[model samples]
Target: MSKKLNMSRRDFLRLTGMSSIAAGVYTIPGVGGVLAQDEREVTIFFWDGPPLIGIREKALAPFDDAYPGCKLNFTSVPGGPASGYNDKLFTSLAAGIPPDVFIIEIGLLPQFLADDLLLDLKPYVDADDYDLSQFPDLAIEAYTHEGGIYGMPDNVASIAIFYNADLFEEAGAMMPTAQWDDPEWTVDDFFSSCEKLTKRDGNRTTQYACDVTGWDKVWQTWVRIFGGQLVDDPFYPTECTLNEAGAVEGLQFYADLRWEHGFAPRPEAMAMGTTALLQTGQLAMFYSGSWAFPNFREVDFNVALGHYPAGPGGRANYVYYYPLVVPKTTEAPECAWNLLKFFNGPAMETIIREGGLQGTSFAEQEKWFVTDPLPPANKHVMLDAARHFVAPDPVLTNFGEITQIMQAQIDLLMIGEERDAKVVCDEIVRQVNPLIKEGQWRSG
Candidate 1:
């Protein structure tokens, strides 16, 4: 990325008549003016930012052409909820001028649904008698709440272990299988590999075996694999279940990976983030979702997806599934739905398949995702994961707030600061239960 030197549009246009663009189109590259202009412009916002404007523009071109009169006025907001995007969305909602359609992460779905901010897409689905069976069961269930459809599975990904094959070979550690049900790949095997793969330099580690950043996603996966859940119930949760023994055991295993076993790096020790550590052969294995595919695709080392080691719950993998949603406040409901329907089609799949997003819920697109001559000779792990994936993060009405409270405690546990997993888990419950009591999900 290069530093931006601000210049007015007038100055830019004056400097050059037109710079060449993709595939010989040499015009000022903007969005949503491919076809004739129309009055019913369906305004939309996505959090992908300006870097992906070209892809978004190309993906929505067919939609614009299909309904020339109902133009899709699109804007790319750079950040997810943490950045200015959701803040702008909430502000727009308050002003009664929210976009016709927008993007949101799965964690915020319950909040949006409980607040009655999403349109009941069931009417559109029923009217078309849409064969929603094509999507993965996880998606169909997650997007539908209280017998009403709110969104369609847009970008999807599942958690799995991505290991550096070369590092594993050099360490003489056993390579993990891609098969989901392989009894050989267990947590014990993973610990052995981490031991062998780690290297030391005079009490200062040179190469770390793995990383558990104690982020929201990583710890949550451990909680799920131990046959535990974060809440009593997803939609109507009254208490935090992380205080249970199963949850504590799961979290202790994660904490011990760094603090006790010395197999993984602590957050402060990692001068360069975990991804960089993996790319440079300092970190042997990375635990993350397919969303990391784009970053890892270009690395010099050979990357492969390992079958997640079996835990007490037997190889449970958590997926972070974000969907494209249409707001109930849209001026043109029909046009918004039309735009959303187009997003679920093939063009969008093509856009996401190039190391973009995996576990997209398309059974037929299996070959497209794995057929690439990439390092992961065993990419089918994704297909198996889709069938058996779990969404462990409790979807409460105040999910974002609850997550902040939970993460604060879990981070200490991940590091050496909090040795007792039960102490951290208990603190999470004590702080987060009140919020859940007031804002647990309710049927709209």
Candidate 2:
């Protein structure tokens, strides 16, 4: 392993001056990289909860047989980067005992690459003649930095509408189309259904139409679908473009769902939880990624998938994925590499089929995901959405800070504190542009 450089918080602040702070300062005092080099044990870490934890273990059981004499040590934390998982990983890195393999959100790729923590998998792929064409372009695109494949995504959790068929039927509202390119599945058509699905009891909503989650990707999809964009370019954003007329209009339309149209529930009612509401028939339509399946499967009602409504820019929605990586610091490189292959191969199948996750590989997705005879019987919906997906915001190392700035402003609109999307969009452009510029600044 090469020498790892430690950057202090002060150093990070001074060096970048952007709102970037690592989970732990690399300068923290600990034996940086002195793990036993002879250990045959390969450690893998994950961040998820519930049945997923159990399913992952079941999927991994074949590893021992796949690679004889390799001991596996696996641990999965409850949440994501904000959920003590980052703290634990960073602590392990500081002590030079980080897991050999781990899965992470795609957003964290830039930071990991910047810290020189992730191993470049190009050599392994080239040596073994590994076929990278199986996975979707975005899955590979998310983890490939400067042509070196640093990660392989276990699944692509593409954004799509998961609606309650029972609620739609009860209200006599037309159901959303499973096809992403369907011309009839427009926002106007969607809202028409929403209005029908909405029921009220003197200002109190007995049943709601649609509650579009204010996740950065979810709202941003509306921006693109409305023929607007958050940045000048998705791959290499030069400045914020969300203040444009289309972007503003798109955001305002969604905000209108709650405040103006009285379709979506208020924050108080939503606090009861979308999953619970959808399960109990209080909500007809809600937007979430394919990962929502496991939690939603518990629902007794009939839940089906719907693609994002088409708009001026066509059905442009976002997709995010979890990529498994082998850290450069792993002592057991061969075992870890084999483990990574296993993750992308067999483990990928189990994770998608049994775990209810959308697959990263397109063929695997069609064969496994599409064929699954489960609720949301229209399994092809997510696959279609993924095919017609929009490129996400530029993979900037400072993306977290950029999103933080955006969310802080956009929240006002979603919460009805600000009636005008233009105000929030303008504020985001003002705040996020420099951070986008800082991507080049950091690279320079």
Candidate 3:
């Protein structure tokens, strides 16, 4: 974590040359008195995780310095168990005390939007003449609902394959390319390479060709590549479509790698987990998000990034992002807006450069993203993949419940409890569709 400075408010104001302004007057660097405002606190609720806490603190420093009167209070809640953080947010909202600013994952945006929990940022953008074009189209579209943008895109990432170069060399297997247009780098080639790289000793396998998690996002890339989608429309999903032929085919291919082909290791096979296997050189390739870059960089093995293998859908991948939004009940909307803009704009560039995790949605910052001594020499591959990225199926409400249900079925399939992909996916639809309908009814 970044060390906090122990300076008094008076000393900080003195050092920063910020003097108290009279009521009904505003002060900025060059701008004179403008809007009428008073000192207030803006509470921001965001997820807690490694590197993120440090990164957020570093990124928020500039905003903190600029807006001294508007004290920024941040609450970091643990992510996952998805219900945990959302419960806290809802409880706060119910009590008529909502966060001024909060982070919303793209997957859960629909539920928040349906509940009227977020403030529409369109008016603010138009009034300020903010260039929405600065962010990627997909990133912007993810937070857009019925023509109004509700959130500011903060962090964007695309799924890709991370490979151990040394393992490839040892196995006499061809290394995958970071180039998206590589004709030879198809799914067939990827599977053949995995076959060559996988090795066994007696009944116990010494090394695996690839490792993938039961996480829906990681495996969903394959589904999209096979020309399938989990829902009819990601932005406005109404029904589950996992039982479709294309989706079933994709899930079968994913399952076969573990059960039928034995090319990918099962979760139980790796006692220390997939990351440990990758670091120990026992795993050749792994599919994950851009956030894994830093973790892989720390390992002794030489790591390189590779594009997702092309399939019938033509190199499809999954894209995800965190959006900064204001609740409808915020007491300090203007201050929250200023902080949100800073977080999505200037702070993004800093995060990309210093954090070395994922790239920002801003196009101009692309140059800063791919540069430097980062482990994956071809970091641009992730940005390239973003062009063909797919968003998660929109679960209109009760997103956490729906995801849990789907993931449970996926877990059963992965662990050999269910052999048929179609059966598992069918079961998912049966259990999840009613919950979605019930949620829609409640929201209605």
Candidate 4:
């Protein structure tokens, strides 16, 4: 009384127009076990930058060859110096026209997740048995929440001290170790080198030892080195811990670089910003992320990479990555997932290699990165530093607001509007804790 069903591989392939055996095995709805012949168009949203240029020029061609049936429609959004991109993205989402895939910075992931904006990628990842072991642990950990993987990392980067070799040689200061575990390369060593490199003309400094331009996140690394935390826990921050003794000391040390040591630049003193200053040989050293590599290569000065100074808490730096995320409302989740895998996977490797992206997230790519003929000839320093990176506050969804509140107090201290580090830390705790509590209460 049972009916016999028969289907050949060729018959299935002909029915679905699928190019792969795997595609034929996985069923698409309404087609039984056959893949659909209809071409799927996936829209991707990403920030417009130099790297995007490389991606389009180098990565896209290979991706097309690999998956001809899937069409990629890219939309470049503006970033940096303003915050319009997020607004635009939110508007698109509200209008029910959100891009299938988009880039989400690690700091913004919590906010996006809290709003239920991202699709859980766990199902796709598990179905394929994707070898996530190829990526750095920190990179994977950043996008994971509540047993769900929301995205895959596009690139990974961390903060490091970039120094001018000419200045260091002229000052007779010992160069910082490129090795993370170099015992002698401590905070004291960093300060000592800065002291020696600083050049002053009477009351005016001709050349500063360092530029503390973007110290908001940089300062957190220092706090960790000094055995302190900006909050009770970076991932699940319930209360501000900047008022702790170690944190106060770390902040005090940072403030001292400008107000006390007279080596680091003050806001008014930096006219052309860190890039120009470093290029012109006016600034000896500055703390910045690996994104500076491309621009630094264009300059005429001799630049080398140095590790973030080790501290009592052991070596520490903030690790960050922008993940390629799929929105929950995507019309073609399967096609979007395919695009995400291809773009962040092997097809994108050539783009990353040629683009001079220093901190690639893939383990296999690390060898290529280190061997590439690039400045900071000691490129291995970044890989070493990655071993000790600290993930940022995970539970705090209101990063933008909290950062603004904390920065305001820090700015007051930096500009002499406030003097005492302890007082400033106390003020930050008083102001930011309420915001966190309010957010938690509302969510609850």
- RMSD of every prediction: 9.6, 11.3, 8.3, 8.6
TM-score (C-alpha) between model 4 and the true structure: 0.86
Predicted candidate 4 versus true structure: per-residue lDDT over 204-243, tens digit per residue: 8898898764368787777788888877865566888989
Candidate 3, position 44, lDDT:
84
Give the top-scoring candidate (lDDT).
2
* Candidate 2 lDDT over residue span 232-293, tens digit each: 76556688899999999899988998889989888777787887788888888888877777
lDDT of 3 at 112: 82
A best-first ranking of the candidates according to their lDDT comes to 2, 1, 3, 4
- Model 2 misses residue 88 by how many Å? 1.5
What TM-score do all the candidates reach, one by one? 0.86, 0.85, 0.84, 0.86
Model 3 pairs in collision = none
* Model 2: per-residue Cα lDDT at residue 418: 95
lDDT of 2: 0.79
Off by over 4 Å in 1: 1-39, 353-355
Task: Choose 1 or 4, whichever is better by lDDT.
Answer: 1
- Candidate 4 residue pairs that clash: 234-393, 235-394, 235-395
Per-residue lDDT of 1-444 in model 3, one digit per residue for the tens? Answer: 999889999898886664454321343311221242446677788775666656776777778678776767778786632748778877877887778998776666777887787888898899999887766677778778777888886667777788888888887787777887787677788888889889899977778998757978877777776777787776556778889988888888888888888888888877787777888878898877767777766777788888877777677777676787888767677888888877767677767776655655546346664675668657777787776555645646676678889999999878878889999999988998787676552221
lDDT for residue 303 in candidate 4, whole number 0-100: 85
- Once superposed on the true structure, which residue ranges of model 3 sit more than 4 Å away at CA? 1-40, 67-69, 78-84, 440-444
Instruction: Quote the positional error of residue 359 for candidate 1 in Å.
Output: 6.9
For all candidates in order, the CA lDDT equals 0.75, 0.79, 0.75, 0.74
